[model samples]
Target: MLALSQGASRSAISRSNKARPDYRGSAFIADIHQNMSVTERGHFMQTKVMSTLNKKGVKAMGIRQVLPFKVLAADKYRAIRNNDSLFDLYGVLIGSCQYLTGIISARRQDELVSLKSSGNLSPNLNPFEHENIEYNLIFKLKKSGNGGKISSNKIIERPIAASIAKIIWRLEAFNEAARSQGLVKGKTLDLFNNLDARMCTLTKTSVKSFNAHLDSICDYFETPLVKMSNGELRRQYLRQHQLRRFFALLFFWQKRFQGLEALRWMLGHTDMSHLYHYISSNEVGDILNGVKATVIVQGVLNKDGELEKLKSIGELKATLAKKYNAGAVIIDDLESVIDLADDDDITAPHIDQLKAEANLESNLEELLKTGEISLEPNFFKVTDENGQVRETFNLAFQVKTV
Candidate 1:
């Protein structure tokens, strides 16, 4: 009897131990479901509250403002999903625009007419002023999608609304930056030119492409020349002209205009002609020439040292090519002369052949001592400042025999 009691106790203990883990897992799953249910309920409640507020003619302004029509429509859809009875009422009200249109029945039409005549629709209404009433009603009807339009009309209009909002935001930011920086009002041209320079360099686009981009910016601001008075328009045009000139100067200074030297020369000469035709001919050329000479001298100095290295490399390569003919003048230590080789001539077939023959290895000791053609090393090592050697392998290049 004692042995039977021990076996039963052991079985009970084993069952209790197995049941504890299952209970813990079930508790975990229940907690997850509870959390999801709370989240869904909270969202539904918030949506319902927002819809109620919108129906009461509340307008929310500022950056956080949502369109009333969209908020109400979303709430209606959510209510339908939740099988709420209020969804039927919302559908009926939205659908019954014939009553609002004064065409439902004779009695209802009479009532609507009476409401309009008595100014019940709008108190203190000027009966003679039909324009504003019509405009407001039409605008409201459009917002409510009463013109046989889908509910998604509100969502479709959002991008246009968001674009306008973004423009306002940028204007606010520009105003704040200008105020804090103590920027002068008349220097808009300078500010625009600086922005243009930065954008051109960053985007790596041409001047014409950059100008097209600027047109989009102006369009976003709604600052078209035709919209302003003659004086204001002239000012804007002059500012843009000055901005273009500034960009040209920036391009010239950055050596980007090197590819179009002839165009630069023409523009520099054209400036002199402008002064000559408007002011004096003889003095203009002399004055402009002085300014042009100064710019040229500055440019020459900036480019002089680099120009010397390029000329030296070009002459050396020309001499080598003439001497070697079809044979390769291998530069085993090519990297040492890479800065010189970057000149335009290195792209020539002869120079390319020489580069192809040359072997580039981190460890050039073997080729330097042997003085013969050798394959580049597959791996190399370099000693650090602490005298510890670190090894590296290169798979990009391998030894080839010709």
Candidate 2:
């Protein structure tokens, strides 16, 4: 029995390697490192989407849970507002700024800490602006190769909603007041920092301390338990990088408006594939199902409570016939078809399968409108799918002169 179990394990490993040829040799380690931005299980799984869907792993905090942590931070701030210790109040408010800025910018902690007030902050033009006001923050990406030159830095501007910006501004005002009282030294001009005996930059130790504060807040609120990697369970705590992941998730929802290219730029990623590694792939399945449900509810059902002849209906029938090895399957009710699909008994049509066929010209035009895809001249030397230089063709006069 032991030998058989060992053989079964070897067979499973062999099959896994065969299915994912990328994991065949030394490339397996590289792939794991590349996918580390996602859920921990994603290192071994075929795709980040599958790793997220597989619930029996180290789960990260969702947006719903993380949003409440902001509230908890607010409550802590309120509790300490009347305290005599300016340091305590200042620390709490600074932590709140970190949390808010972390989620909004989706930037690394070091980049976030390096934010300057002069070039970065552009307050709203209207003085009467309140909740609707937005402030633009310019982030300067750090480059070791550029010798700390501002001209060589990549600048990314992000507009932050006033509701959150107000908190950051409040912290800035408070820091100024403390500085006037000879509390903090004005050495580092970074937007966010802590005031010890002197003004100091926040480090990795400070992040860990902030996480402990989150853990304590969860204890006070009596939040539910979260599973630890070692099989022990504890209350959920927020991490700086977790905010980056949540921000990526938020960006995915607004992809139709904000688009993927903007997200890639904001995340400081040169490659779309790397940007995708940052996003939670499990949301793709949920969004696809949502599109399916919307089609069924609105497109398939009629105003008179009757089924209409949809292109999806014909497709569903053909899918069912081939799936069951039966001839001429009839779909009388889409509700029944949806139920069968839920039970994994039948393959039903979804929104994606109902869309028109793709054409290069139309796709390129749509992508250009969304600012997601662009064309380059021969000097740029863009390669084809096979990584070879594509031949340039002149179509200005409707002539294929390569």
By TM-score, the best candidate is: 2
Cand. 1 Cα-lDDT: 0.29
User: How do all models score by TM-score?
Assistant: 0.13, 0.39
> Backbone clashes in each candidate structure, one number apiece?
0, 0
Give the range where candidate 2 is weakest over 10 consecutive residues by summed lDDT. Answer: 393-402
Off by over 4 Å in 1: 1-84, 98-402
In model 2, pairs of residues that clash are: none
TM-score between candidate 2 and the true structure: 0.39
lDDT (tens digit, per residue) of candidate 2 on 1-402? 111111222322223333333544664576444333232222222222222232332143121110012334656533443332223434555566677777876766556766653345566343235545567766766433225343336776676666556655654554455444433444544566543311122222244555554444344444555333343545555666667656645543443323455566765667756654433233322332232233333433353432245343455445444544543222334444445436533233332222211122232233233333222111133476998774332111010111
Per-residue lDDT value at 24 in model 1: 41
